[model samples]
Target: MDHTAYIAILSVAFLVLLQHLLGLANRNGKNKSRMRRPPTPPGAIPFLGHLHLIKKPFHATLSRLAERHGPVFFLRLGSRDAVVVTSAALARECFTEHDVAFANRALLPSQRLVTFDGAALGTASYGPHWRDLRRIAVVQLLSARRVGCMSGAVCAEVRAMVRRLHRATTTAGGAVTVELKRRLFELSLSVLMEAIARTKAERPESDADTDMSVEAQEFKQVIDEVFPYVSSVLWDYLPVLRWFDVFGVRNKILAAVSKRDAFLRRLIDAERQRLDDGDHSEKKSMISVLLTLQKLEPEVYTDTMIAAFCSVRDSFVAQAEIDAAVGHSRLINADDLPRLGYLRCIVAETLRLYPAAPLLLPHESSTDCNVGGYDVPRGTALLVNVYAIHRDPAMWEDPGRFLPERFEGGGRAEGLFMAPFGMGRRKCPGEALALQAVGVALGSLIQCFHWGRVGGVEVDMGEGSGLTMPKAVPLEALCSPRAVMQDVLQKL
Candidate 1:
């Protein structure tokens, strides 16, 4: 019995030794690959090397880092080795030629729970699941052709927006200080709700259909509560305090999720009933498409999956255009869309200056590879500083200025210099739709009204905290109907 036991123990130990040997061999191979390549210069620091220095409003901070460290440099972001690609040339290396190895995403805590385990395209890792979801979203939901079909929806919504804005203009209160943020945010919400729910808020008619103010209040409360939870926080990076959540953050998120889910479920149930009753005209939305798909191919689509898809698509679509409305103005329209090409420039320029995700969502190195002549180990997290690349003084004439003309007449888009939509396989698929949405909306606002700062209030260009870089003040202005449209405005 003792002899047999000894043999079994010896065999187990032998197998463990073999595994360690192979692991060491792999590590050695990876190290050799790095030695043969150009490594980025390490910033000066001890255990938390380069971590404390690179902080947020990251574009400005990284610009300074680039001045000190050059185009490519290595730094420690928490325990991770982040290879910062600042210049357009380095950006190209990460996105173009060496794209495949760096296509996977960094797993953050908030994104995991909020996005239903990263099934949505924006936060999902680059793979089959992401590709499939993106294909579904672009082809079925956000394609140019599909978005064009939404013009009727947009016109109807804008008419309501005009009605509301005109009401504000004529309110006898004398030059109302319009919060463009409130108007634009509502415009965006209405469009998104109709696109996904296929119904607008019904005007109060009789007692039975009387709108519940309490329900409306609850829904608004839920949305306002959830706005701040999308950001990447210190706990998101640390992971140790995730359960604790630091500031009752987890409870707030849980409450918001519960409220949001309840509202969405009610909408889904209503849509289902509408479909059953042959009343498809009023309730044909993106949710309906997903539901229809789920029913027809039960094996492929689940209800939870449909819910996640709807939630994320709504979030991205809703926030996509407002990113462009930083300037003090109101609703943009078709008449103004063509004339305000410079506004498109501002949107593109803003994306360059303050890209939605400055770090561009972390990507993992799938294989040991060489980048900027440095050996990158497999599983290395890649943080491509799109902000740094866009503002690299070498790429543009006056990189710091808010100029839109730079994109015109053969501007600096040669390499990866102006990759606001990202590059290669991971480029944002909703880019065309986002462009049209921003262009048309901004253009219309500029065309329909004469906009000025409220009470001669200075337009604050300060930035705020979020995954998306939104303007701090959220745009405030005084707007009046144009001279030509005054008669039309009066009739309304």
Candidate 2:
């Protein structure tokens, strides 16, 4: 009797657990009969759901799924429901008509910790707080006029990068094996440092040298630790794993965030002192601009809130374009960038093939919305598959090739559908500044150096797994200063 009773209790408990799981997986259970969800592919487990289907180089996995299931499909990612939109038309619909409904960011576990609990603009929900942050970002920090005013700083950094490469080649007495990824990261970080605090970064002593200032080093380390885990952690999708603090992601992210906040606070204090002393040349730095705003509205832009607002590959059809447009008479300047149309085309095509972030930071729907004629229920996470859309056979001819001419003349995209920086309200506000910096740097490098494969073979273009699509292998090339530009290099 005791054994029979125990077996009956076990069966009852299993039934209850199964029923709860069914409800958890299909939270729309009450309205399931009334609603129309996009088709979910088969082979989902009880607890894992479609998470079992997810694989690394994540956007590629989603693209393949789009091929098997239609362009728009629903996914049960652990407890959350996600709608992955892969077509250009569907991407348009999500960002256009249904944009507001899908404007909020998913409250991912990583974002919750790293972003100061949605205080940062990138992770903030769509509301008054986000509106104010956007206003400040546009009007004060990233305005085109402001970015142009900072072009002098950008030009100076580009010169430094050229000179650094030139010095390395001279030290080697011939073509030096150059790792472009590390050099480029330092360059970009240097530029960012200059913008943030007007700090002049010491160039890396070698390819293996660490990033800039003590603060900058901490910043770089934090980014390295936090970026890959931000939206992709398994704990973010699974409550049980999160409960166990799987991989120590929560502690790791919080520690990084705390370090960043502390360093930024010190910078803010220093800047505040400089302002009191009437040092205005630093006025162009992003920190200076925000501090100035804080004076007028200290309540709105608290030092804590002030903390929030803070924070690509090269090619050559590029070389020919730079030579024709700017000539070897001098190094390329920010102004010369706009005229190097072919160089811009090269950059555009590269982005089309390998977007920095293949899948956009997930956007959460604030209300029920229609996407590709299917209902996306409120609170569902929206993932726009930019990779798949960019490579669509029907939309692009020979989508696999590195054809830069496709963007030449009339071939310029009708819209930013080739949105490398993303689109809609949350599109990167610093896009203009980024392009300006990239244009000058690429044009200068091509005009200054003769780059060749280290082993007389094609450069490998394998992709690495990250929020930013890094090259699988660091690019090592034999680089020699161009004889044609030696006079210019000597002057610098």
Candidate 3:
């Protein structure tokens, strides 16, 4: 009785174990078969995966890989899987058809550090919070109406910059050699500050103006330093390294964030005080607008979100457009922006050649999707190579040449192929404001000054290493007031 019972129990246990193993094997095989992963480049190594293939100026490296592996290819960087879309067709698919699936941001370590752990509009994941931030950004801060109201501020800043450059020319005793990139950055920052907070950026006679408040100067420096490292930090792809803080990048980022937050707090405090004092004389700053909304929806519009809102050189068919539309009677104003269609084209063209964010803020897929007919798994980091898409020879006739006419009368249509500020639901909301600021500033410069390359040398135009593609060599050029506009310039 004991032998028969033991044998029966053993047989039943063995059958159950065999069935379980067979079911496990079938499930594993089915899962593998269902997932049609995108084509990944060869030479993926253990642990490191394909991270070694990624190099500085990552957009170019990804573009080169796309040339070999195809426009839409998978990459495994450390423990993360990424899909790089380098062609317009694939990019279109990602933004259009698969837009919702890939609407969320890939919150990298560095981005989290700079953005108050994804609290900022640009860094926040796609969700109700993001929607609220975006709504405030679009409807309140960056609407065409709001941007138009702030045009006075933009014009005032541009005029001030022109005056500064004019003073430089007089001081130099002729056409002066000016490093334009720093000036451009200063101009951009000033316009943004004035528009957002109704406060002027006090320039202390030099770029290294010691007279500037420590907080102000430190804030500016943090901005300059943090932007380039936002996406390029080692810990972005290799999260494990963050614990070690091997290069002290985390510490540097923390310090920068602290300074940034402090500076923003000061601005917010000042705005609140002014509001409390009932000084409604000035046009309300963007900060004030957000604060009003914050009172209604405190949960959505936090100080960090308001602070986040507080965040180029270009071409000459542009000049002719400006001349034709604006003439020499008065400096170009935001009112003239609509008529200066060709000038807008030039801006669009410049962005195409050199997008502000070369590898646009990375996006993450919320669900499995198909891009360019390739399977994109959920949680895959999506990098759209705007630099490559903009310059893809397949999409453009003479993609390398600088031709604003390519955008003539069809610039908006061409936006599908170009994404300097990104595309789809998650695209940068500041695009309108940026264009307004840059268009007026660039146009005024061209209208008031005759620009030439210094020493008869070509402008370097080589791209630098940064999230924003700065010039490796800051643009230095010779400048003098246009003879016809001297009267207008002198009045300023």
Q: Which one wins on TM-score?
A: 2
User: What TM-score should be assigned to candidate 3?
Assistant: 0.88
Candidate 2 lDDT over residue span 1-492, tens digit each:
699999999999999999999988687576765777888899988878999888888888888888888999999999888999999888888889988998899888767888888989988999999999999888988887888878887888788778878888888998998898988887788778777777653444545344365556666876786676677778777878877874677787787788778878887887788888988873468888888888889888888787886701345557767878878889988888778888888777878888878888889999988888788889999998888889888889899987877888847546536877777888888888888888788778888998888878788889888778788999888899989899999788
RMSD of each: 7.3, 4.5, 6.0
* Candidate 1 residue 240 C-alpha distance from true site, Å: 3.4
Question: Sorted on lDDT, highest at the top, how do the candidates line up?
Answer: 2, 3, 1
Question: Which should have the higher lDDT, number 2 or number 3?
Answer: 2
Give per-residue lDDT, candidate 1, residue 112: 72
**Which segments of candidate 2 are over 4 A away from where they belong?**
1-27, 201-211, 311-317, 413-416
Q: By lDDT, who's the top model here?
A: 2
In model 1, the runs with Cα more than 4 Å from the true position are: 1-49, 172-174, 201-223, 242-248, 311-343, 353-357, 410-416, 455-458
Backbone collision tally, model 1: 9
Worst 10 residues of 1 by lDDT: 311-320
lDDT, residue 312, candidate 2 = 16
Give the per-residue lDDT digits (tens) of candidate 3, residues 132-172.
Answer: 88888899988888888899988987887888888788778
lDDT of each: 0.65, 0.82, 0.81
